[model samples]
Target: MQSRRKLRFRLIVSFALFGFGLSALFAFAALNIRTRVEDQLVNASLMDDAKWANQQAREHPGAPSGSRLLTGTVLSDRTLYKAPLTWQSLENGVHDIFEPGPDGEEHHYKLAVYREGGIISFLQYDVSREELGKQQLLFSVIGAVFLFGLLSLAIGLWLSRKVLKPVSELANRLRDFRKAGKAEPLAPHFADDEVGELAHALDEYSARLTAMVERDREFNSDVSHELRTPLAVIASTTELLQGSPDLTEKLSERLKRIERASRQATELIEALLLLSRAERRGPTRGETTEVGKVAADVIESQRPQMRGKPLSIELAVNAPVSVNAPASVLSVALTNLIGNAIKYTLEGSVRVEVGDGRIEVIDTGPGIKPEDAERLFQRGVRGEGAGGSGAGLGLAIVRRLCELYGWDVSMRPRTDANGAIASIRFS
Candidate 1:
């Protein structure tokens, strides 16, 4: 594909070629006019010379009373003329005279002499006026060609810009839609050309894309709703098994494991449901919610999960750090991030820092490898240190929620610390 600069250069070259073609046509017309004018002048000069020769023949005495012709020549120097000569050996029709003048000037003349009786006559005429007029015409043609060429160049530029304006606007709109991840359709302008066809096509494409996205959102929401029932039954069954008293010690231990697995599965299902909901809820409805308050609530709610673990919690939120997003969605996202930090950290603390339009969750567990950072938020991909206890959907859900709220998320190894730090910045 050609770059924009190359395309523009080609457009300019095309206009230049068009202008050159027009100039060539004008030059051809001028040349034709000059040739016709020269031909007419030559014919007129010949006729005038013939008339003078006939008149002189009538006035001349019967030197032979035959059709003898006298001819004269005018040279290139206007004041020079050759002596008249009677030619008896000439043909009876027309004859030409070539001679030198007084100043060695050279000229040519055609003489036509005829007679019924013996007669001699001469005709002298100058052909310089025709030559001079031809020179003037040639010079005028050259000047007009140059002037028209410049005029065509200017007009060509204006015409090119006028033709390319709609194309440029379409390109700009496509670029903006790609970068912003949403389309703003251009206002319609009607024309009976290819540009009009292109505009109609683009409008149809944007409409189809918008419809497809809306359908996908609706499908996700429906799927999430359908899965919730089964998840809830599994959670209730596991809880009932853990609470039953008829179980043996070993079986009770197994039941406790089942309960834990069921709880984790329930949390994973709930996270998926929340993620689907977040995706469907567009950004326009987000409200200002305090990040620090959400952080504190998540930490308090998850305190029971960290009962026997030697993990510390640190909150460094000083000022009111708020974000324009759904409070419930933000709470779920932050809870997942903090929970992942705690689950990954073996012994050290999990730190939650909140600032204006920013949140950071850092853990002092074994840091994630550089290669794994890219897929950390991808579904079903977990760090090497994450055991079978995690469903690997927590970070994915967090990332999805952040995206829905127009937030940027970055995860990397904490260089100054010992574990990974997940940062979220609100837009």
Candidate 2:
């Protein structure tokens, strides 16, 4: 997936860029106009100085004494020359040049040439001050651009916060609702705007969802209560039938099966109810239970399912182990694993090995697909090798039970054979 920029950051960057672009454009235009105006003014002044010096030469026919104008003349007769030796190669128009002045400082000058009455006059106007002024103006414009750019950034930040405050609040409220189960109503906290509408919608959706969850809990509780009564009656009746006098072996075996099925059904209901309650109220306290007893009960309860198949079930209790967890939860988790092993195995044995803090159900079933490893425990996701008789919820319930008790459950293929091993480790 591609990473995305946040809305607030994008907005602030856009405004800042806009500000910089406008400031740069204005600076460029201002500097260009000022340069053009200064060049024209300097050229006009040089032209006027050159023309007046030419008139002075025409009237006097010699050097104009005591004149402060930095002017020189070269007569065509070569009889009355007053121009510098460097002006001998001068052109007939204005030229801007840099030369050393009397004070030894490099100076910019506009040299203008005017010819009239067989005499050429050269006027040099020192424009170094004006050049420095123009530079100062350029610097001022650059400084203004930089200064206003910073101001624009500050303003952009302010505007972004002002505009995005409502959005931020809405986001905080959504996060708070997830963590704390309630948030202030957004519409009442903000103005009637688009963000307000989004907040209002979220608030309504949260309310509806909360109510729906409450209804679901109530329904599960009611169903569990309603189902337990008949299950208890069935269990008592099955026990009574098993104890009847003159009961045949065949009838006694069938009654035992019925009793096991009833108990399994009752335990299934209880597991589901406990799972639902745990989701709503968090995990309840656990009690110390004999792990071996739970494992044996689950294995015995699942034995009837293997009757018609060429498969065997074995229990390998290596050590006397115990765990701190709900006995029903442990039974359900083990039952799901053992049941799946028996249900899927075409032949061979389903082995339950009890070890320290763990139980491993190794089966000779077709090994699970490596591609389905991550998804096998998810609800409604059946591996390709899973038989079609189940809703794919057994492992999902097992996963939930493990989560509630902080246990670890894992399944992987057995590399030595065409089988899989499911392990549940208690923390």
Candidate 3:
């Protein structure tokens, strides 16, 4: 994957490339213009000098002399025959010529030929000096292009810092708010600009979010408080009824079920309250709960759910396991895990193992897909065979409880059996 470049760095590179391209373009045009103009002027001067020398020779009828940079030759009927065959039929225009000089090296020159009145004239001008000047001009333009690019880069850096200063300040302020777990009015700290508008929007969002969280906290508290009152009454009433004498065996068993349900509801409320607050409920000072005892209790509470299915629930205490949390918290977590196992298993056994600072509930039931192991823990998600009455929040609540207390919970399909294994590692 390609990594993203920051906006500030992009701007700097754009400036540098634009400067280099424009400078190169201008240099190219200037060089073309200079070369064309110099050639035109040189051609005109050569042609005019050739014509003048021809006329002077015609009027005076004598040989002419020339300077080091220029030479003119007037050829008449008699002298034309002495000229080389190549020069005899030359046209009347500027033509480039290369000839061997006294040093046996090639020399470059421009020949302007003129013909009129039985006389042809040639003016030759050396252009090697002009070529040297063109080379120097090309080097100078190249240097200027690089210089302009560097200057543009410097300017871009300075402008970028100034332009992004407000944005950086806003980001820093938002970071501070996050660390402090509270938000302040961002607009008050910024000037009236785009950044300030952004800050105002963030402030509004933070206010709405805070208000919504406060309402949720209050709602959970109110619900838990009201629910506890009725649950307490039911528990107290059941206890009183249990003290009655002359109770039949069947009646006593029914009462025990009611009592167990009432206590389960109370524990469920406590767990839900803890989840709502997203806080840990540590065991009381100098207290710890044994994992095996909690697991056995949770299994017994959930066994009533089998409803006469050909399913058996078993608990295996592999080793002495304990955790630094209230039994109610552990009960809530284990209840959900073991309850799901027993509910899903149709005819086979559900085994609960407590050891090694963890508990594993393995059941022979309709196994889960490996891909959906984590998804099952999400709220509003249900397994394939889930009953219509299920809200799918059991595993979600369990996951939340585990996270609150720094426990690790996971579900996976059993390798040797057609069922699932769920484990919670308390570390």
Q: lDDT of model 3 at residue 92? A: 89
- Residue by residue across 42-152, what tens digits does model 2's lDDT show? 677767777777776777766662223564443553753556666667767788778899899999788887677767767677888877888898888888888888888
* Greater-TM-score candidate between 1 and 2: 2
Q: Compare the candidates by lDDT and give the number of the best one.
A: 3
Query: Looking at model 2, which ten-residue stretch has the lowest summed lDDT?
Result: 65-74
The segments of candidate 3 whose C-alpha lies over 4 angstroms from its true place after superposition are 32-69, 72-126, 386-389
> Ten consecutive residues with minimal summed lDDT in candidate 1?
74-83
Comparing 1 and 2 on lDDT, the stronger one: 2
TM-score, every prediction: 0.49, 0.80, 0.84
Q: Is candidate 2 or candidate 3 better by TM-score?
A: 3
RMSD for each of the candidates: 10.6, 4.2, 3.6
- Least lDDT summed over 10 consecutive residues: which range in candidate 3? 60-69
Pairs that clash in candidate 3: none
Better of 1 and 3 by TM-score: 3
Better of 2 and 3 by lDDT: 3
> Cα deviation of 297 in candidate 3 (Å)?
1.5
Once fitted onto the true fold, the runs of candidate 2 whose alpha carbons sit more than 4 angstroms away are 1-25, 44-96, 103-105, 112-123, 149-186, 189-198, 279-286
Which regions of candidate 1 fall more than 4 Å away from where they truly are?
1-13, 17-148, 154-211, 227-290, 300-310, 314-317, 355-357, 368-384, 388-396, 406-408
lDDT of 1 at 346: 73
